[model samples]
Target chain A: MSNKAKHWEKTKGQMIITMILWFFFGYVIFMFGENINSASFLGYPLAYYMCAQGSIIAFVVILFWSAGRQEKIDEEFGFTEKEDD
Target chain B: MFKGKFIDNLPKIYGTYTGGFLVFIILMAIAESAGMTKETIGILFVAFTVCIYAFIGWLSRTVQVDAYYVAGRQVPTVFNGMATAADWMSGASFVAMAGGIYFGGYTYMAFLVGWTGGYILVSSLLAPYLRKFGCYTVPDFIGTRYGGNFARFCAVCVLTLASFTYVTAQINATGTIAARALQIPFELGVWVGLISILLCSMLGGMRAVTWTQVAQYIVLIIAYLIPIFWISNKGGYGLFPHLMLGEEVARLGELEAQFGLVKNSAAAVKEAGVPGGLKSISLPHSEVPAGGMAAWKFISLALCMMVGTASLPHILMRYFTTPSVKAARKSVCWSLFFIALLYTSAPMLATLSKLSLMDPTLPTGIIGKEISAVMAIDWVSAWTAQKQAFIADFNGDGILQLNEWFMRGDVVVLSTPEIAGLPYVISGLVAAGGMAAAMSTADGLILAIANALSHDIYFKIIDPKADVRKRLIVARSLLVVIGAFGAYIASMRITGILGAVAWAFDFAMSGLFFPLVLGVWWKRATRQGAIAGMITGLGSGTAYLIYVYPKFMGNPAWLGIDHLRFGIIGASVCLIVMVVVSLMTPAPDSATQKMIDEVRIPSGKTILGKQH
Candidate 1:
């Protein structure tokens, strides 16, 4: 495979892993969080708490981390362009 | 702050806008104290705020193609984030989403999760690449990636359908707010909304939409937070509603048990003279779904929503306005942060509103009272007068049973201030905020549809040599026509706001999701594959929705999915079709492959990737 294709493969793998992380935090926790409802967090039901606040916090973290990491990936791969602005 | 031109002016512009808003609020207060009726105050408030937006649109009017098409491609990350958040939160989200949570309970988290998770998809998979592609519209990317007008035309078709469906709902929402605030007929109110939408979008295109949306975001977030904060304080949660909602949940559980007692008592039923009324009484508060099927429905709905959020045309267009690919990625994070401010607060607002309505101290509760006494509370009487809520002692017991109290969920958020006994102006402010949410979204959707027509069809296909002035004329005129059509559909009131929005999301996801995602990621994806995938996906989704869904709603689960979750089936079909078609067909030629590689890079000086 060409170098572009190899880079594509690596980035694709990373993207999939990132997506799986989101799926776990968004879907898995949402589906099974109720199993932990007996537990409480900071005066709130754990399941409801995760659904309302925790999941969003997790999403923000994942997005920022992925964005920061992708910049590094691009730079390492020599794909970064000079800032046009 | 940095010393760049736009950056240097940002703080001054914000200051002026903020000062203007504060002065308007002070004037409103004086009018309220000078004995203006609440209805008059509400109408004046909406009118003043909407006119301000229209005036901003007039001020930012642009004839240049670049400014009209993508706001000159210079929006900073933070302001673009604000604009995007305003554009994303529609009337359904601002008004009905919390109401859905109030009525549907834990299951409604599908909306919150789906929408926010979709942003993850956008930030990771779509936004940066699309920004690097540096095109004007989604169709532009598709056309260039696939190297054909056919693919672009197909994209335009899907964009129009999806955006039209979404815009109609927004117009409907705008009409609802106007009708309630002005005490006018719903039909007339829709015309009022259409006029404001046209005024904002027709003159300046996306440039006007972006700046006005920033203003709308500020108004909307403030309007949303105020009543919720008031409720949180009143509920003894101090200011942190998220942390303190567990106690409210526990208290609500106790109230549910008390209502359940009334539901099961045969003596009470016979005394009330309404047999089988217990079920309706207990049904509204029973939010938890039983067994595995409920979980399946939740996951499917959430999945549909997440994918749908990523696929919507108007939203994708917002990313094109950012200054750089990195700014595009950063804007997604900022959009999520701003949107979370409302989403996290919505459930808390719903819970508090439910508690307030059921509080035994209020006349709204299920207590024994004379009819006159029960009707004495101003908010209760106000809702009943509007026919939004009703109380009837069906059993002749002279006591309101839980079943006897019925309210349309749409009014829950709108009536929260009155229900909580806050001042009338707060309700007026909420109305203004709702209008802002509706108008901001409407402005974006109308421009999306019109841009597809003018840029994709007129300039690119019909008149490739059309001057910038000619293109601007076409875009502006199309905005007027499309705005009127959307308003007419909304006035017809074919569906509720949330239902229409859900359908729009599903439609957009089914048709556009696979093609748009593959276009950027897979270099081998051919024009034929995209066209085939979009057609089959859209065709099958629409066919199922039109032919099978109504019949299936009452039947057992079809493959563990419901009508609302049909986007999953559509998306699955598109993925299979696209992969098969692309593998069977020849890959895109060398030039297209080169362009795809260029899009993959975060920042590159590429000939094809210049801003249009």
Candidate 2:
């Protein structure tokens, strides 16, 4: 396979994984949160805590990680721009 | 220090600007302490802020097409991130999202989740690729990728429709802020909003809007964070509300249970008293639906919001202002961080505000001396006098039932300071921040619509050889016309702020999401498929919204999905249509395939055929 095609496939894989993680963090947690309302974290219902603040923290972390990972992939494939000093 | 003078001087310039703002705030505080009428203080605060934004707009004025179109492609990643956040967090976000949370409870998490999650798509799927394409507007991408004016025209139509809807909501938000702050009619407030937005955007285009948005971001974040911190500390949660919010949630939960009991009993008694009386009002947070169809509704709404955020034209336009593809990617992360700062704090603010409102010491429904006492509690009295909130004895038992207390969702953030008994100046600051949010978003939306009209419709289709000067004039003139139309729609107040914003997102996602995503990823996506997809998706979505859902399918939604989730259906139809049609049609030519390859690469140096 061409190097470009291989890189594309890898990027797609990474993206799918990231998206699945997001779906779990965002959707699954919210959808099933009520099931865990009895569970307490930091003095609140676990589900309610997720809705209030946990999911947001998860979102920020996911983005930062995804961004960092994407930058690494770009560098590996020589897709990033070179900085001039 | 020896390289570029502009880069060297950046911090100094920003420092001076920050210092000047602080001085101005101090002077304003002094004037307020000198006993200026609150109305006059509000007017001055708004006027001063708007003038500063206008001055920034004037400073960045440019006749060059490059600068006018994309801010000369020179904005640093961090500043662009700030600007993008300011542009993304509209009045709905700044003023209404928390209020929605306060009123709608867990169900409204659809907004918080959807909006923040959408940034992941932008960073991972859209921004870097679009930056690689190096386009001026979203239509430029469609026009170039599909290789025709027909595709361009369709994209322009979608852009205009989506942006017009979004801009009207923002103007409505601005009008709401102005009307409340200035004690004027909403119609007049909208007119004031239009003039200020036009002044900032009509002169310098994206260049001006970008700088002004960065400044606005500072004002808004400070405005948003201050009251939350104050209230959080007052609630004994300390300064870090996010860390301590769980306790607040627990307390709120207990209060809710107590109120729920009172509410149920009140409803039962009221039903026995008056057989046909309206339903007793429950605590605002008590209506969050749970399990089964409600969960499906939440999922669908969240999905629609996610895609809609990714697809909105004005938002996508913000990425084009960044200097490079790498910068674009970095900026998305920053935008999410900045936006999350406000999004997470909103729930804390809502909880704090709820606690204050439900204080047991406050006089409830008594008519004589107790009513006077309640009226004397600044926040309660202020909102009551304005008819934004009220307390009444519906059951006439002479005691205040928790269910009898009602507050408008939109005023929670605005009345936070008054509720906490913070000085009146902070109230003014929040108003200015709300105005900043509304104005910043409005400017971006207006520019998007005008750019589509002037660049896609006028320059590309009408006069291909139009000079730079003529193009700039057209863009400016279109801004004025669109601004006036937006103001008129806002004055009509057709829908609530969040409702209008939701429709804008749904429409954008329904029509543009599939096409834009496919354009970047699927090389075989034909022009015919794109055009068909755009038309079918938008047409069907609008049809369902206007006719089918409202007229034919009433009561329970089809498959537990309501009209608000129409984007899901529209997007599904679009993806199917595009893929099926593309498979049947001949593939795009080799050159078009090559252009797609370049778009996939992250480097900015990859040139496609020719510059526009």
Give each model a TM-score. 0.93, 0.93
Candidate 1 RMSD to the real structure:
3.7
Model 2, span B1-612: residue lDDT tens: 234665456556666776777677678778888997888878777888888999988988998888898887778887888899999999988888777787667777677888888888887789888878878889888888887999999888888888898999999988888887777898999998888898888789999999899889888998899889987776577678777766667666666676563454655545544222222335344234667777777777878888998998888889987777888888888898898889988888877777666656433222222444665766667666776876666567555556665567777788778767776777888899999999999999999999988999899899999998999999999999999999998888677677668888888987899889999888899999999899898888877776535555555556865677778777888888889988889999999998888787776474532246
Candidate 2 ranges with C-alpha deviation above 4 Å: B1-4, B261-289, B361-372, B376-378, B548-556, B604-611
Report lDDT per candidate: 0.81, 0.80
**Colliding pairs, model 1:** A81-B603, B272-B395
A1-85: candidate 2 lDDT, tens digit per residue: 9767777887788788888988887789767756776787776677667766777788788888888888888888877786430
**Where's the lowest-lDDT run of ten residues in candidate 2 chain B?**
B361-370
Name the docking class for model 1.
medium
Candidate 1 displacement at residue B433 in angstroms: 0.4
